[model samples]
Target chain A: MSNITSQRSAPFVVAQIRQDFPILKLKVNDKPLIYLDNAASSQMPQQVIQRLVDYQTNEHANINRGVHYLSETATLRFEEARGKVQRFINAAETREIIFTSGCTESINLVMHGYGRKFIQAGDEIILTVLEHHSNIVPWQMLAEEKGAIIRVVPINDAGELLIDEYQKLFNPRTKFVAISHVSNSLGTVNPIREMIKFAHGHKVPVLVDGAQAVPHMSVDVQDLDCDFYAFSGHKLGGPTGIGILYGKASLLEAMQPFKGGGDMIAVVSFAKTTYNHIPHKFEAGTPPIAAAIGLGAAIDYLLQIGMVAIAEHEHQLLEYATAQITKLAGVTIIGRAKNKVAVISFVVADIHPHDVGTLLNLDGIAVRTGHHCTQPLMHRLGLSATSRASFAMYNTFAEVDALVAGIVAVQQVFAGSM
Target chain B: MSNYKDLYQEVILDHNKKPRNYGQIEKATHQAAGHNPLCGDHLQIALELNQDLICAIGFSGESCAICKASASMMTVAVKNKTRADAEALIQEFLALAKGQLNAIDLIQIGRLAVFAGISQLPTRVKCAILPWHTLHAALNSGAETSTEAEHDPMRTTIGGA
Candidate 1:
């Protein structure tokens, strides 16, 4: 609480948070690292790091297997972490949460398992132009394999999905509607709840890629009634190589297991192999135990600060950055959606995004440049790529000011030469 | 913010703004396109060779400052040099950009030294190397190669020669 207040007052709270991540303290060209590429991955907090260290040191046992005390203790902690994630996203049951390597694996799990079992030839999978390649490529592969067609919901010049166009893309053949809750490239907070409900009306299953959204807002999978919700831990102040895939229990019971292995099955006889129930059925082999514990710690950290407060703080930062950067000449923000998370993608007129990113780095300000793993969106926007500044709870308004100053420097450097 | 000034030197920005030989070359004998799909950087390097010595070199595409400037400087550096010299320069420049070498004495190659700062950014190494990678590919393909560079390592695997 006090930490959050102190964090709000400073423009460079990320530098403080950077100290919590031991790697962030490392000098890059004798300059303090200003990591603004939260969308790619976030710096892990000290709590999360400690949690991983403690888990491996003290609770280093395989879960749900051995009858020994260590095994039982490990199982309890793992399941407890699952429960925390269930609560974090407000999912109906712990069984709905399946841990994976990351968001890409989670999306692949859904696309390969559920998509293979349900989708038929000629069926349409409705996606948006604004999805990250992780969300789009798996479905594209599934569609190609299943003889299904993909129908994309177009976005406006502002990068907001055209709701009316999305509605039109819907039909009986639209078996699944997979969309990102927030655009990784554009930072548009899509009306996913409404979109999910509309898809439900047509009896279409909807999978929400909450990788970007879950870190920024309060996500209630049950309330949204989305068929599936997926996110990565690294984006939310947790360790890498860990993610959550939340499916409705009913759907989980129906879908086939994505990978076959020891933990995912009940009995493995030569004659017949019985699979495990719900969550375990999808979690094959030895899971990322330390990373899961780190995610739990990250969730605990966020809960202690409160998601509402974090969201409010981020919204303020986004507003400040947007207002300031928009004032710069030749700067055109890609997405101007009414509702959005903390990402802002823009291009400074003749200056390329990579150039903007490079120049900004000199100011100890980090940002993502180029298409942001959203090449289709770049094609839709009719641009090569845009520089993106994504915010997290630790990010501050002063960092936003630094970003503006960096852009101004870029303008001067290029303008003088021109 | 303190001393990273070398990373964004004035010369790099100058070249980025007013790029040299930025358009397509007419009747290019060899050409290759390179794309950094990660950053959406697309560059087409065109070479006009008269026998062994390079007669003209041109490029056309959109990319970041490091890549565009590198490409701009590369075109100027390779012009009138032997094909083998151009290939060797590409290797030297690649090594220099990676900071494997302290300094590269390529006659008049200047400001390219600024990209030495890019090696400090592990993620951006691809953005800096894209044009050179493309030039390498175009030279290897042996096709009448036009408008296509070798396959980008960032996008595709480079197969056996």
Candidate 2:
């Protein structure tokens, strides 16, 4: 529960949280692992892991089926998890939450369930340059299928979206807006609530990709009024293969079912078929029951520790890391957005990010190095790739120090040869 | 994983710093580009062949040290050698980098043997072998971007880079 409130705070509660994640103690290359790839996927805590073990141990059964004890119990637990997600994001109702495989699938679901149903030829879908491929590609597929035009909102030099350009892109033909809550590559936190409000002003439904944001800060779908909010469970310290898509009740009711299966339909026959209600209509086949329950446990863990504390600790890490990395010569940190998560992406002199990442691994540091599935953003920045070190609540300042030293060592390795 | 010391030895680093024949050749007899979409690596290989002998060879690209070094060493290894020799060496070098060669082939590889560590670094195998892929493409007038079906290890796996 103790978040590092100050820079170099000696007493920290994060150390206790780190104890809850067994993987943090692992060593690589004869050194303690410095996992800075949290943006890629956050590690699971013991609480969530144990929840999975308990579920598989006793509550194993196919949900939404037989009247057997295990089946009913499993179905109850699954619905309970959905309720937890409803409360977690402040969704208006549990029926509005549809479980998917991941954030990508959630976005694809909206594209299939809502987009395919509404979008038409010549309709313009507004997106942003900072969006990960997950957000962009699905819309592109929809546009390609429907002959809809896709317009992108440009970003400023510091990686902040040009709000003017965003609003300018909105017009009578603009039908949908999809934006990320946080930039996976740069850590830029877009003002989703304001952006959603602007989209709503045009009466265009917006989908907020909160996969990167939810892990760092608190999110309220009702407050944002975003028609659809999607995130991956893995990014939120839960198991993979499970995610939640929170859609407005009216929107959920209006959209078509994303997939066809036994649970999604009330009745089926060769002659005619009738679909089921809202959530079940969207959740098609057998869902990832264990992962859903585990995500609920993760929410409990986060609620117990508190998001404000998590955000505060991660911000301090970002501040300290930025200051430390900025002091190093021949290093340039990309994405200097005024508002950001605890992700620092940078370049070392002229060294390729792949090289920097490899050398860092020698010191047991794990950082992501690539376009980060944001190729369009990379094109806009005029860089092929960057090295990104993303912090989680479990990360410590000492790990940040290790990352800096690792970078320095990497530079030395290349510099000596040069 | 191979130690960084072995993976990026002096020869590899020296070539990366001052790569030999690190530029395009005008009116080259053959040319091609290699791309690793996973990590955004690119390199152009151009060679001039006259009467079954490689008279000139050059390359240029934005890639990691392993790739650049391999390209640099490849040009030095094959230049002025016969077309048959260069093509045979290319086969040997590819096998060596993939760790598919025997002791005799390793010895036959000579200076190009530095990339043997690439086989152990699964994530970086593309970076080390990309140049040869381009060279193979250039010699055969193959596609503009010779990915060698890179497998893009990054694509098959999820989580982390």
Candidate 3:
């Protein structure tokens, strides 16, 4: 129960929760800010910001190195943060959660740590058209190095993944599968649970790219039964440069250490080095300690409001935004999947997305324009790029109205050009 | 929204709708493609050079309105001009786009001055300068050029090109 749904059942409320994000009050170009680019990066709440300030003010220390009191406090808080992440995603163990720079590095970790060790030549790695470049490129690099083939799962015209086709892709050659829990560009909520089960049947492990899914809905990695789960913090209203990789403990133990450095080794000498445990073995350097703590605070903030509440509000916004945009002439909604999050990708006829983005900025309505790093999906949809408006828990119905008004103003500016 | 009109203006939109010299120039002496990787804006500039003069110029590709309009105006402005004059114009237009233009440079930009507002939109400076980069690349016989400021060969070899 996030704040929105909590309003229906209990004392917590969405309006009070909205005040937690100070950027909501910002005025861009003399107009009230209407931020719909949450899918790219959501606005950080003051709670997370204050947590960073407090941590740096009181407990700033390099973790696990010193015998000092501050080092012990920082180390305790950092491990507590890891525990928070473990519980947030319903991870099986604390050691299963490895912190990286972001979701990209998390996937790359698997590509290096797991894929390199086990995957051999002639193996086929299954991917979907809905994957971001972050998910695709690392696998491509791994495939190139290992002489593996990448098999793709296509999407229908409505931008929904073809589940039947995905099932058909598996054979003895299929070694692994990586699919997005949600499509960033189209807002399509993929059936990852079923897909993971299908992969498991083939004895192939599945890695769900939860970068776009975790913020909008409750994610239970154990329930999905995915071998690995990855997500970014910034997209979850936390600080940038921090993300999580949830791997099955056994799988993590079996894989090679992705990087070797301080705090990641049990014993280190020039002669031979024995690596540390699961999480630390992958975290090579002095990780983003502050960001991981902020992400913990962000998780607290979301849990306080409740995810069900957040998803409910986002769905309402999606419905209103979709209905309004559909009524406009020459404006096409790109993704109309039966199941989707609050993202809306659309194109204004004969006008490039850059033009639309520029005009919307003048109206203080910020939406992401271009391929959204899912160029292959854009190509599959027969578009070079489309403007996207994504919602977060803090977003309001008025903000959706502002977005519509902004689009109308953009249309008026280029009225007869088409 | 008026801020957009200042950037998009009536003429820029018209040029985008029906770009002048909007095709490959047959028997072109030199040609080069330009790309703004940030937004996937791409276009090629082709010119038929007769000794030192650009006899005919044309451009073709897929890009945003700003890039299409900039390319359209560039072909119109540089067609039939001497090689030196065209190169000078390219520098002036690029300077104008980056908002580094002096009053003299602004005047030199002429009708192309409509794109001057791009400097305020840092994300769009490349869109306005892409055509100029491609034109410069075409004259110098480069295979391609990017809108990235560091890749400007003219900045290092202005007179040589």
Top DockQ prediction, candidate number = 2
TM-score of 3: 0.95
Candidate 2 lDDT over residue span A1-418, tens digit each: 1221221323449889899999989989889999999999999999999999999999989998779999999999999999988988888889999999999999999999999999999999999999999999999999999999999999998999999999999889999999999999999999888999989888999999999998888788887889999999999899999999999999999999888987999999999989999999998889999999999999888877777888989999999999999999999999999999999999988899988998888889999999999999999999999999999999999998889888998888887842
Candidate 2, superposed: residue stretches over 4 Å from native: A1-12, B102-107, B148-161
Q: Write the per-residue lDDT of candidate 3 for residues A1-418, one digit (tens) a residue.
A: 1222343444446688778899989988888888899999999999999999999999989888779999999999999999999988888789999999999989999999999999999999999998999999999999999999999999899999999999999899999999999999999999898898889988999999999998989888888899999999999999999999999999999999888788889998889999998788888878899999999999888887777878888898899999999988889999999899999999998889989998888888899998999988888877888999999887888887888878887777676543
Error of 3 at A271 (Å): 1.7
- Angstrom error of the Cα, residue A147, model 1: value is 0.5
Error of 2 at A365 (Å): 0.3
- Deviation (Å) of B118 in candidate 1: 4.3
For B88-157, candidate 1 gives per-residue lDDT tens digits of 8777777766667766554444656666666666566666677777777667653322222353332322
Q: Between the candidate structures 1 and 3, which one is better when assessed by DockQ?
A: 1
The candidate 3 chain A region of ten consecutive residues with least summed lDDT is A1-10
lDDT score, candidate 2, position B130:
77
What does the lDDT read for residue A309 in candidate 2?
A: 80
Question: Residue A272 of candidate 2: its Cα lDDT?
Answer: 90
TM-score of chain B of each: 0.79, 0.84, 0.87
Chain A TM-score compared with the true chain A, each model in order: 0.94, 0.97, 0.97
Interface RMSD of 2: 1.5
